[model samples]
Target: MPSLVPHLAAVIFVSALAACGEPSSQAAKAGPPPRPVLVKTVAYADRVTERSLVGTIRPRVETDLGFRVAGKVARRLVGVGDVVRGGQQLASLDEVDLGLQTEQAEAEARAAAASLRQAEADLVRTESLTSKGYSASASLDRQQAVTEEARGRLLRAERAMTLARNARSYAVLTADADGVVTATSIEPGQVVTAGQAAIRLARTNEKEAVVSIPESLLSLAKGRAAMTLWSNPGTRYEAKLREFAPSADPATRTYLARFSIPAADETVQIGMTATVTIAVPDRERVARLPLSALFNQGTGPAVWTVGTEGRPTLKPVDVAAYEAVEVLIGSGVEDGDRVVALGVSKLDPGQIVRVIEALQF
Candidate 1:
């Protein structure tokens, strides 16, 4: 009985050691905990595909203003970004030369008038002499011709004076319409030629967004579009197709499109950056996933799809289009398939995962 007790004690000691090691063995066999992830069940729908393009807000009627006559610019009354009204004086040239020309014309007109008066008096005196038989008829006729020549000279001088006055007025450049000045090409003291673009005026009554569309998607840009300003993102403006260039740009091979904004507010300024969203009618049903779920390992695009047993497997997908927040998958994933919506890069193939949240859409 005493020997049996010693053997039993040794057996109990060994059993205690084994029990102490059992926890470590179990932990080693268990490996890592299941990765918690957010997932969404893939579903196909008739999704309306939308494409966004960056564009510039511009006026429908933008005009380049210039001086009517050539002269050195003496002063610029309006500057860039200045609001101007019709007939507002925008700039002026040095009027010294113009004034001199006007004065010369006026003097010539006065000289011609005085000469005509003198000739008329002479003709009257000659006719009186001829009537009294003191002058010959030929002398009176010659005097009459002189008076007519003087009258013609006076008329020409008056017309020259009018032209000089008009030229003087042309030295001052004025706005032709009500608009905002967007650009100024000439400064004070700079010389400008006739019809040279000195200022760019954008009419404020109407506005539009201008963007370039690629040939592949030109057909989709026909209908109404939506515009959101980069400065004010919350406000969205509706735009309709106003005009599009008939031919593509030779260098870019892209078509220029202009969309009229029916409800443009004061916040929408010229030259502001905007985004145009064009929605294309899509009839086919396609699966959509959040952009975070997409994974590209150099071979092609893929996503980590969760199986029915809560295991994640890498599946290659054909992406039709990519949006700001989501991706449209054309094929390789069926409806009801669970896809990792977030943290896809951290997931491994065939790894078990616990879905912390299931997302829709």
Candidate 2:
């Protein structure tokens, strides 16, 4: 009886081994379980980014005014921050010497005119005597030469007189355009040389906003921009790019940009602080998705889109640009498509997935 019981136990153990060796056909047919993934609905719209920089309002035309003739400054009619009109006197030089030179030239011109009249009278008498054969022809010829010489003297004197008067007028420095005097270097008795910068006038008609931008943002400065005065931030003025520095500034390593504000009014004064806003426009339509959603299997860039049937399908996408946290897709995905937002690498075609809806912006 003991031997029979041992044989029965051995048979049961053998049966258990056979059952364990059989293949798992059910698991092989069913495959892996559904993968859980986060999904976002695709939405297409313009993505505009705004950048701002501090700037200053400046006049388009700034000029330095100085005297044309050297002299002691007799009076300074305008000071810094003074408003001046075109042709308005700003300063005057001492006119004592200029007046004397003019008077001397006038006196010389008068004397020459008198000598010319006497020579002409003598020439007429000499010609009359020569015609009657009472005077030698040589005498008439000498008188005619004297009259011509007097006339030449008169012409030279007149030219000197004109120059003297011009010099006298140059003593007064006047504004050439309507502007505000931003600087003055001359006082009541300061001695200034000719063409020295005695005053600085900035034309108030045309105004511009000047700013400095780094090389990364050079394109923004060149493109469309707007500006608002610090004093009046509520009002915005459209700005047009008018000037740009071809090279970076030596110290700041930034390029200077100037934007013309055609709508600037009296409130926008020179030297007022302003902010220039550069809003880059959307050049084309594109869809933006998280970078994690991008899938690549050596073919190209793509994304895994989970369909309504809980299955994921790999779709090729044209990448317009790469951003800090997202990729701009030009095509291959339509609006309202359910796109896997994360863990796209582990996904395969024909694989079912569990969609965890994520907020889409």
Candidate 3:
């Protein structure tokens, strides 16, 4: 009798449970609800892609400031990065020698003037003597020649004096325009030659971003660009294409371009790294869809769009570009169409599909 009643009762309960589960299992196998498939909506927009480039913040106009006259550097008033105004003194040469030369020239000029006056006086007296028969006509002619020679000497001396003054002025190196000193090549004791580049100044009037653009992205040089500094990326400056190299650089094979930033501030200094972005627009209207959504029905690449009838249809599209995971469709798909992204091959053209919204956590 050893618990036979309990065993029999357990067997009956198990049988009842199995009988109830068989119908449910059959119903599940028969498809209680259609499975939800991954889908993407089609919405074509005007194509505009952005390209970012690395470059330097450069002045639109840069000049190498040099001394017009040669001399030992006496005092450099402004150094690298110093702000200088137009005609502002940048450095001064040792003026001792230059000043002495100027004084000597002045003295010579004054002496020549006196000599000319004396020569004229002699000529006048010589003419008077010749008229009174005290001097010969040849003597008067000689005096006249002497006066002309003196006058010529005076003119030469005056010109030399002017030149000496100009040379003295050149001793003090000054800025030709308002700019910042970007480089310095001389020390106080260094002797520099005339027209030797001593300092490099970059004009702050119009700042530009200079970048070497690759040949594939040459269209960026013509497009309206924008810039941002690496030092401060949050701020942005609008820019326009100011200069584009007609040919590519020999080494890098990239086109040199300069985008003028008329609104650049102090933060955009010379040599600072910057990023230029070009938003190049395309005339073709396109929409992006996952690559898996593309299907080949022997005619061309196509995507499965679930129409209002909840039926799948193969719609052919022109592939504008093929990317890693997405394809740009140029045409053949209207906006607001639901495209099947995954398991597109399982769906049949005649099969009526139930649209189930995807549950996202």
TM-score of each: 0.59, 0.68, 0.72
Worst 10 residues of 3 by lDDT: 352-361
How would you encode candidate 3's per-residue C-alpha lDDT over 1-361 as one tens digit per residue? 8779999999999999999999999998776355456778888988877789999987888998788888999998877778999999888889888899999999999999999999999999999999999988999999999999999999999999999999999999888899999888888989999999988888888888899999888877667689999999999999899888999999999999988898887777788999999988888889988888899968899988887877788888899988777789999898988888888888888676766543321
- Candidate order, lDDT descending: 2, 1, 3
Candidate number with the higher TM-score (1 or 2): 2
Error of 3 at 55 (Å): 1.1
Instruction: Summarize candidate 2's per-residue lDDT along 8-53 as a digit string, tens digits.
Output: 9999999998787665666678788889999988888776656899
Q: Of the candidates numbered 1 and 2, which has the greater lDDT value?
A: 2
Off-target runs (Cα >4 Å) in candidate 1 are: 1-49, 118-148, 280-361
User: What does the lDDT come to for candidate 2?
Assistant: 0.91
Per-model root-mean-square deviation over C-alphas: 8.8, 11.2, 6.4
Q: lDDT of all the models against the reference?
A: 0.90, 0.91, 0.87
